[model samples]
Target chain A: MSQLKYALYTGCTARESTPELLSSTLAVAKKLGIELVLLDEASCCGASHLQDFDEFLAYVLNARNICYAEKHGLTMVTICNTCQINTAMTKHKLDHDAELRARVNEKLAEVGLEYKGTSEVKHFLYALVDDYGLEAISDKVTTPLSKYNIAPFYGCHNIRPSELQNESNGGENPYVPTSLDRLIEALEGNSVDYESKNKCCGFHVDLQAPETSNRLTGTALVDAIDNNADMVVTPCPLCHLNMDVKQHHAAKTMGRDVELPILHMPQMVGLALGCTEAELGLKHHVTKVAL
Target chain B: MSRKETHKKVTVKAFRFNAETDYLPYYKQYELEVGADDLVLDLLNQIKWEHDGSFSYRRSCRHGICGACGIKVNGKPVLACKQNAMELLELFNNELVFEPQSKKRAMKDMIIDKKDFWDKHEAVQPFVVADIEEHPEHETAMSIAQVENILDADYCIQCGSCHYACPALEVNEDYLGPAALTAAYRFTVDPRDEAGMERLELTAQMGSGVWDCVKCFECAQACPKEINPIEKITKLHNLQFEQKVARSNVATRHAEGFVHSIKKHGILDEGHLVAYSERAAVVKHIPEALAMFKKGKIVMPWNMPKSKNLDEIQKLVEISQTNKL
Candidate 1:
């Protein structure tokens, strides 16, 4: 197998909230003979505050991370969707808009940095298929996940077709082959038929208003469960965090009890890659997926 | 229905950029051989690891827990971990494209600022509001169910995907957005919270509060947690109704007009609707009103026609009232 090099930029959530995904993905990549390059000088990707308010501040903070990547002559590979969007969007803006570029450069100059706009923002999943190749990834799968009935949850950011992302595939395309989905299938896991696969999980909304999110999340999960999905699979930590931990909240608000296990793609891949449950971060989860 | 053959070779054309050299953004094409279940996140990782080391993007917990992976997969905001790759491979089929989420400053490729998203969330004082007298040196006895009831407010990952997809936030940045309001609702519904009234008052005071929502379901659709922010806004509106807060005069007027129309005509009377709405317009334009009347736009005034289901409507209202009681 030809070795591939990637500059891995694990966002804060992977570090603090879903570290298991990072550890497991790294482990799996190593087994596949892939070189995982850590961003030595990387800071926060600045995905958290950019969409809320103060676009300029978001630019400044994210630009710092981008400049670091540029200095290393490496592209970014992120594990979180928000970080990917924020970084990709920032790169898009800095590269496309001249006035904005000039302004951001002036700001970067204050911090002893310059924004020339050249690095490519790529998600880890994209890197997996585009670089390592799924066939290559499949060759390394030692164990099949045929026992697990997995239902994939495609959160809003990664697959959304928006003006910012400039996706050729319009939003709401159900046929797109996401890496997590392919991974599950490759492992012989049961990928159930579910509507609203690409729908929002209401994580951000839940923070501000619980009652509203309860109804929506409740409805979505109920639908997924009703469709006979044994477990909910996702690649984003926030989705896993909210679905696993907040599921009780959703069930409580709706006056019922339902337990759905949330797993990161890497954990699932790790399990399929013959990694033990301990190696996959299964123990760290609030709700354990019975592998 | 006929059977469709699934293709293995999926072409992805992703949007590429950085803050260091590209004057104009372009698309980079990669042919990925994927199974029926691969997600886009896996493909991006493959590309970054092998094809290009300079690809810049952000992600964590490739399972949608942190909301850090939000991006435009097709045009909608989605988490990379939650998405399937074959879905895109077939849809665009050798022409899949991706870009960053809109309305934010990009850092390199996909990373944007996240501080403001948290700031907006924090601005709401997102926590349980307890105004009840505290037990001296003791904790209140609450069941797991009770605690669970209000835990939805605690699920916010602050991914900003909802905020990015929020149309109201797109137009009005001052709006608290869905995630923040969901946080507020967490406290409002808490039985242990004694300061619900205070929180409600504060939320009701903002211009972009509950009243600003046009009832667009975008935020709800954008939420990875399935938190229906629009429903939360409606609940806040109900709270306003209970508190008798008239901050949403337009909403109030619309509701009253609706109620009055239903009350009088056994159905909505477009004529009376116009007259009631005149309260907001301040002046009734006789000519425009007449024109509408002539055009049969005023359903109530003309008593144009009753639905064949009038009894059903009345029965439904009665059932609603009974359920409320």
Candidate 2:
């Protein structure tokens, strides 16, 4: 397998709240012979919050982060769906709008930075599936997880709004996303088909309307459990937090007793690659991965 | 090979409902033999004409115009006229699940009551309201750029597909949905219109305005005409901030808090974001915050261990602000 290097932008959630995600991601990448260079100096991708406030600030902040990856001559990969979508959308906007690019570059010049739009923003799953082919990943799996039945939860932002779709993997079908399923299969796990597989995990609205968020999260979890998924795995930290950390609250709010283990995508891959639960940070999860 | 031999079988699972007869909605699956070149609308037409005459649905200009054949194909909002039947068969594994546009009251099979959608659109006053006296020639004198802006907004077919696909409207019925807000943005940016501030205020009214959107981007995907409603909503947010509109809304607070936190620490500090954005509401959640802190879900003084590139980020923000003016 050829070596792959990427400037990994671990968004705020992974940096502060989900440290295990970062550790697992690093461990999995190293095991697969992929070099994930951390963009330590990079700030937040200015998420949707920044975009809602000031479009220019959001553009500038993302452009600056892209510039850091470009400086290292590497494409940027993000674990958090919010960061992936935000940075990818910004890059798309800058790429299509030269006038905006010129304006962004003018601001960037003040900080001795310039986004030439050379670097592309990719989700970590996209990197794993597309950059590192499925065959390569399957070959590296030392502990085949054939006994496990995993349901892949693709959070909303990673593949929607049309423009931010990952082009490398048949783009995003929204209704029937196979990227996560392919990854699960590569780990020798059965990708269980379930209703509400593509539904939003309600991570975005968790703050504004907790009840509504819980209801949405509860619906998907219930569907997964009913379909007999051993556990759920997601490519996003926010989704992991919602499906794992908040599962108890969601179940309580919905008047049900639902305990479903949720794993970040890297952690699942780490486990299948023979990494211990501690090494994969599975113990940090609120819902225990009994398997 | 003969054309008959090339045909394929497809199963359509459609939602069936009747306000007069049915007590509850249910799904009815229909099997059909369709040609490769057939559109979903054609398949529906064949089903009604050849298989089941009682199976009712709506369709008009079947060439992707008119926007009449909007329905969910396998849980995705798409124009039946625009979707190739063979491709959909391949995509959904020879079976398609159809339902009337979601978040809408179904009158019958594949038809929804769109009165709520029209009412929301009218709430925004989606018309060019000129401050000056109205004249026929005045409308004709718009520049090419001004005409383009009006045309972009006019692209909406009132299909309600976007309205149905929206998660916000699913939860909050009164939310000024993607289609309505896109129309609101249309009038707001019209060069000849004088109701820019008025329309913005209308959308900002009630808690379900532009701010209510979770930025899910489903509406943009649902639109068959490629009209990006979420982008329009974001532009409306920009207009709200640029015009110095209402400051008390949670959306405004969140935006302001997000920008302030990023400028200060070069990253988002959730504690600061909640404190700054929620203000007094933050006090109400002291117990929750403490619990999170105990569980190590959050770090207090969230803006600690500041970014090394803080100075550079500040410079970028400062320069961008001046450029904005």
Candidate 3:
């Protein structure tokens, strides 16, 4: 078998906001013997603003990073779901959208960089499920989590329709796979399929209007809590941000404390890496959840 | 100082990547030792140095302030430095599946391209814009309270989590998004910025601007810095009252209907609320209304119940408005 490896693109959030996920993923990657290379000085993927308001600027920014990965002769692996969506979308746009590709190429030329759009952008979840396989995962099982029952919150961005993603594939059902369920099963935990897994976190509404986000999130959370989810796990930082930090406000609006603890998949994975509570920075949560 | 210590061998499943594929991906698992107080960051660092040096991830400050270390720790978004590995051991019984946040591009193990986040941040024109030029000898021009108003907006660390979590940004591809709107609000309340009117106009024009938001509060929640982009946007909406630029939009219509409904009755009147909001371009759908009535979803006069505390609700709004003025 060929030795599998990839170039790592830890998005800015993981670098500055959620270090535990980055560190934990690296730690686990090392133990798994996966050769991962770090992309230094990686530019932003034009996450929301550039892509939404200024596609040309977004293409320039995302293409530059693609150029970086191409120069290193490695594929790109992303940590943030949004970063994945944006980069993949940009790649899709660059490869298929000729006008956009040319414009972005011009912008990249300014920085002495260019993207061929050959390198593939993969989310860590897809890599884990496809490359490592459950058999390989099972071989490394040291501690069993048969007793844990978890409810996975997929959030909207990572698993929604292709139009919702950066890359819109006719073959891909954006709402198809429940990576969270598979992840829970891999960890030897019970995956409780709940109704709120694919629903929007009301994040956009929250940004534009509080009452709507609050009311909507309140309804969704109440259902999740009612479904008996021990903890709400998601792959997007914004999902965690909304589910955890805004929990108090949601509780306020609903007139009830739906204190569901939010966890990033990497932190949960880090726990299985034999890390302690303090090692994962659990104390920093807006709403404390007893692990 | 005695603390309960549980020593257990834990399993770690990590995602593997290659830059060459056009399709599906998978996982790799490993074994490690976990102790009390060990965080996810500590464990990864240990693995990187002791087991494999090729492991790559980004981290800074080791606290939640930097907003750089967002990843999926066992299927949830988190700051790795802020997460305790031991907590996962207890929460999930010591089994973990680690991956990067799903929607963004993966550079290697835990990183994604952030050029977009930074560019989007810069595109918002994040710097404070003031109307009046500074004079060395001039006394303080802005009020402390006005300065304080923009404080929350100023604290944004540009994590991009809000942008990542934003569904509108995912689909519309033109909205200014929470971070940009919040940035706009920062300038709107600057007390020195002459562009408040212009800024508001620009926001109104941007399809993905404040109007596009479905009000999910996801941005506010995802914000590691607790800037509450929602509140900032709300403040901007309040500024609309002062701007007097209300021609007719979804938000304005909703706000007006809500205010008028409450003013007329103690509580919201479904009939009047719908009728008033019908004036909005987005909400004008007679067929949808007919369908609601067909399905018996719309409540009739006697079938509909009013809020029991109507008087109290009316009194609150009246008092707040009087005091607000």
DockQ of each: 0.02, 0.56, 0.04
Q: DockQ score for model 1, please? A: 0.02
Interface RMSD of 1: 25.1
The predicted structure with the larger DockQ, 1 or 3, is 3
lDDT per residue for candidate 2 within A37-126, as digits (tens), equals 888778887668778778888899888998999999998999988898888888888998898999899989988989898887888888
The CAPRI class of candidate 3 is incorrect
Preferred candidate (lDDT higher): 2 or 3? 2
Winner on lDDT between 1 and 2 is: 2
Q: List the candidate 1 regions with Cα displacement exceeding 4 Å.
A: A48-51, A166-179, B1-325
Instruction: For candidate 3, give the lDDT of residue A10.
Output: 75
Model 1 lDDT per residue over B209-237, tens place: 76555333567667767765655665665
Interface RMSD values for all candidates: 25.1, 2.2, 20.3
